[model samples]
Target: MKLEIVRSCIFGFLLVIVQYSLAQEKPNIILLYADDISARELPIYGSTVWSLPKGGDTSDRQYRAQTPVLDHLAEEGIYVKTAWAATICSPSRAMMMTGRYAHQHKWWHNSDKGKAPNKKGSWNLYDSAPYTLEDIAHKGGYATYWAGKTQMKISGFNFDEACFTPGEGSYNTPIATTDFRLETRKINGQKKIFNADTNQEATSYVQSGWYWKPHVQLLNHPKATGPLEWWPNNKAAKDTFGLNTFGPDVELEFIFDFMERKQQEKKPFFVYHTSHLGHDAMDFLNPESKSKWPGTPKISWDGKTYTRIQPNVTGDNGVYDTHGTITESGIHHHINYLDYQVWRYMNKLKEMGIANNTIFIFCADNGTSGYGKGSPVSQKGTHVPLIIYAPGMNMTKKGLQDILVNMSDMLPTIAEIASVKIPDSYEVNGESLLPFLTTDKPKHREWIYGYHKDMQIIRGDFVLKDGKNDWWDVSENPDDLISFKKIKDWRAVSEAHRKERDELNKVLPRFNLHATAHDAPKNGLEKPTPLQLIEDNK
Candidate 1:
């Protein structure tokens, strides 16, 4: 009897351990990060800015780009309404990776390292620590994949596999739909890019042939391994998937490769697809750059459905030329392509039977350049789309979540998904979204913030105030925002509005940076000389 009792106790303890481990298992996370996109550009956001007729500004028409995939995903899950990011790329991406604001991370602007002076040298934003959301997910037992733009210059982040566009190089190869001819050579232990075309050491090729006949490098990929070059040993590979090889399409191919390879592996995966899809630099790629931008694919619409282009281009080399005239507005086609890719991602997951288990997030770094990219006076620069789609997983409230979310929240949110407890030693500013996402009544942030150069902004429910504002409320009277009388005193506004402003103002000390180099404190962060920064980065 004693022996039987002891055996039963041992089995129970073992079963408990097994169940606990299973409970702690993390869900796969895929951050579908976009480049320059704005919240106002999407139909889902209901912004009337683009509704004005086009031609006066043809670029505005592209904002009408279709995104059925994202639309459906938002309809099925949560579409964050008032999400925020930095007015620029590096700072926003840094916040997402490190889960901290500019004050904490010191990535105040988009200048090359060592050029900017403030005692903080020019290093990649997240270069300080060896850990990040990538490290967190990997350490928590997840296979990681990072593809597309590697602007952060992040050394590793512990990714099991990483493929990136070397700065921005025209991947124009002698053959192949993809001109994957870029390679990396370690010099003094630091990875340096080598261009086969130049038979010598290469310089920054950010925009030589980035879009068509493109170039890319595969690092730590599973099937397509090479010695620091592109697929199949990096030497010019044959164009198996001839012609029409859009660089963005090739970028997505890498993403699909990651998903297809890892679907059944039991171990979850994290994908940081930082696509160059949203920003407006494609005009330089147009064959006729003088008079036209690359046209959008000739697509047809039937009320609620879209018929995408199906081009028939034979032979190899310059086959991308057969893609026909780019009919879509420059950025609009890019936006439409973004939506199309999202559709593809969704369908791929559904086919693999992991769509229900995966967590897919789509958001942009900042706003469209020349539109919202660097505008400190308007929220257009900071407001971005935030969509979360986890079919089988729980969300706070589906369809539309009109919460005020910050870019800084992404890291902790990933940490929450992994069920990995952040160490006490790490001083991260963002809070985990686990409770807010899983529960209905969990209160979201009462205030949101943004920083770029010397300009800082604090926002509440009805008012958005930059450091220079005289306390005017732009969001009130949504239908007639400019109708509200200017307030001369605190008592001029409603109790609710006044209380909201006061509550938001309490967090003023949180921002410790300036709006420009001149506005900074005596020993505060300083911008590098303009000419040097622009030349160095370019």
Candidate 2:
């Protein structure tokens, strides 16, 4: 009996040792998400804007903007020539967090009208979504930190530590209300301040807010105050110079600080850095300065000045001043700034000696504003930039994937990279890209779908827009102008799409609508709801 007991103890110890060894092999994940950048904007993706002459002589060559950092990343990492995300910010973010389609998350719009005004509620981050990648990372013995724009209503789930500003803003002047707080919860007989809410001021503007100099609140204790910390600090809060101190730069600083602290702890880390660099906010400066740089307009959000810039015009004048032209160049400048930030982030990774082991993935949340945001434009609305750089990954230097991948794929991909097994109870709409990322075999899907109050399906070079049985064959047509003209009977196309959509819908699991609904408790807030059941007229 004594000999048997000794053998059993030895086996148990060996098992624990093996598990620890396996756990140590997990890769650190860093998601560098850019907001509202289109794939066409990158120089590697064949954009004329990236090749434009420096110093701005308005000419044919001037149309292309400089993005050397992005171009370098493309050369060094695997670039997905075709990737997709939701057409807007909130929905795309929901899809990314849940690994589900827009229909599943039910965050079809930025703000749901169906949410009752009286019912103050937020999405439960833990319930159905499982623990997010951040949550999983924390559980897997890795430090998790989120830095940048966080729009999800759910207060907490997977982050061990986090710093975020409410809503989304431009890169130049970001008005942030930091309402981060620490909450102590007893778990496994230990008192821990695991959940944190950083209190900061909420921007008065929604869409167009300050990009450079703006008011910001710094929460001393983020984990405790919850939402109240976000309230503007009338006495302590101060307006900072935006032009001299850009928002992206500030975000990078925080990220580096977090990374250094984690490195000292000798723990692998996960950083979800959502960058606001690519998104454009109109240039709002003095009228004389604005006139000197014509074509720019001042746009505000929530009654606060955000962006002021004019639109880019094509024809008529021989005299071209790309540098002084605020309209088009302003937007390009934003893109250039984003590229510069990307370069800075890469350098930071290298300086820390964590570049090789860290899995750096850069992507955009959705399509650009003009061509992609609100409408279902092919390549414009769905196509986004995806690049992965990890020396430890043994990934190819340059490769293109033609697969129909979605933002939902990110959750699974990250989980797989970390060697964590996602719970079977959690239904994921995306498949892991590990196979394609590691091998030469291309993963292709028969059809990929994009939905936002309408259904857009892509199959073998053909796109079909579905709305009430109105099916339009938008194949071979890249722009909406041609597709819009080709469609005659909207009802027929919609019906076909609905039929096909219904069949494909079963791939996702059923969720408690009450739990998943944006305003589940139904307090009668009069907010716009997600996916209002369409009446079948046919």
Candidate 3:
């Protein structure tokens, strides 16, 4: 009887060891996805051009962003030289989540999408794709959390929890005495945002405030009573709701709370923080200032620690006093504030004792609004930053890798990190980076592809095909933002250039949906399921 008790104790110890080993394999993943920011906007990309405070020429050194956190990340890990997403937010997000381009996911662009016969009209992302990143993470035994901007439909996706800023649902009801919103109303049968300060129509789209006095929503949150509920519903949150509240700050608070809970529960977490920092919004706080994006709460980084000053703005109904607290509006300011947020993320990981067991990725949805966004110009719209840091990961390439990457690759990379195997039967355009990241692989991919509505964009080491059907010799890096030599005659260029051009041209036909001019799939036909499409292709 004594011998039997000893054997059982040894067996239980071995079981605990096995469980711990398995947990270590699935490292926590935090995908810090920023919105509408280009590669150059971040200091790491080394672009001399920067947008002025309000609006002006791009040749201003003073307007450049200061990103110490991002710089350190690049120095410590890796930053892709060239990464592509779709020219806009919605389709780019679809590619990131589904690991497929428009042909499979059918999110062609912001205004253009594949149609469905159902009441929801447009084809949803899950309608065509086999699984989303959230679904894959959940399957791999990770708690999935989505926060900040949500451009895609959340109803069909499988996020375990979510904390969203404005756009997911209805905005927060104003307290009248302490709220500020970019409120809209129909005047003369047209949607317009009339600025109270200027008494003129605002240039931006009419929407609730996302900066100061921001609107927020929570889904399946621990504090919430139901599946979907407006935030500030809790007693403590309600008392703190006021003009000084920033949306991004609120997003961080909930995310941190979720992280703490998951850590205590011994569950690996996947956080898709789709931050709205880079995107421009109508400045309701300084309506007459004519700022493209609203000022964020000021933060001071003295090369080591970052001190974020709580906003001291006081006012309601469009007139307010900033008290020198809010930083001036510029894309650079947005980047600076984002750097501070990165520090917060890193600090939290360290404090939780999970720093070494976390994989952090920093990237953006599309190019900066005025410079790129919807445009299909040479890498302008599609080109964005990609930085990755995974501690204890045996990365072959460290800093500044000259590799071609796409937003679609994110899905498979996350799946691999979570130890989730994607079925071979289901078609996935993205190639998993796990092998390349861990092993001594020299290069990642030979080519990367993108699209803007009907136009197909393809790029190789030597050649590039823009959305305008314009081919260019992109062998040498340019001094300016975009200065690729346009090839009027393919016959004049070298055989290597010609070969690459031809290869890229051949790739476009595979992705072409041959959709109508309106950007929906031809004839309003419902697209096939991911497996069905793969079978049909076979």
Q: Mind giving the per-residue lDDT tens digits that candidate 2 earns over 170-191?
A: 2222234321212344568975
Which candidate comes out best when scored by lDDT?
Answer: 3
lDDT of 3: 0.80
Alpha carbon lDDT of each predicted model: 0.63, 0.53, 0.80
lDDT of prediction 1:
0.63
Highest TM-score: which candidate?
3
Candidate 3: stretches off by over 4 Å: 1-25, 171-179, 188-191, 194-201, 516-538
Clashing pairs counted in every model: 21, 78, 0
Worst 10-residue lDDT window, candidate 1:
529-538
Ranking of all candidate structures by their TM-score, best first:
3, 1, 2
User: Order of candidates by lDDT, top first?
Assistant: 3, 1, 2
True-vs-predicted CA distance for residue 492, candidate 2, Å: 17
Expressed as tens digits, the lDDT of each residue in 430-466 for candidate 3 is 9877656655555678899998888888899989899
**Per-model TM against the reference:** 0.77, 0.66, 0.89
Candidate 1's C-alpha runs over 4 A off are 1-25, 51-63, 112-121, 167-206, 223-227, 231-237, 240-243, 282-293, 296-325, 474-489, 514-538
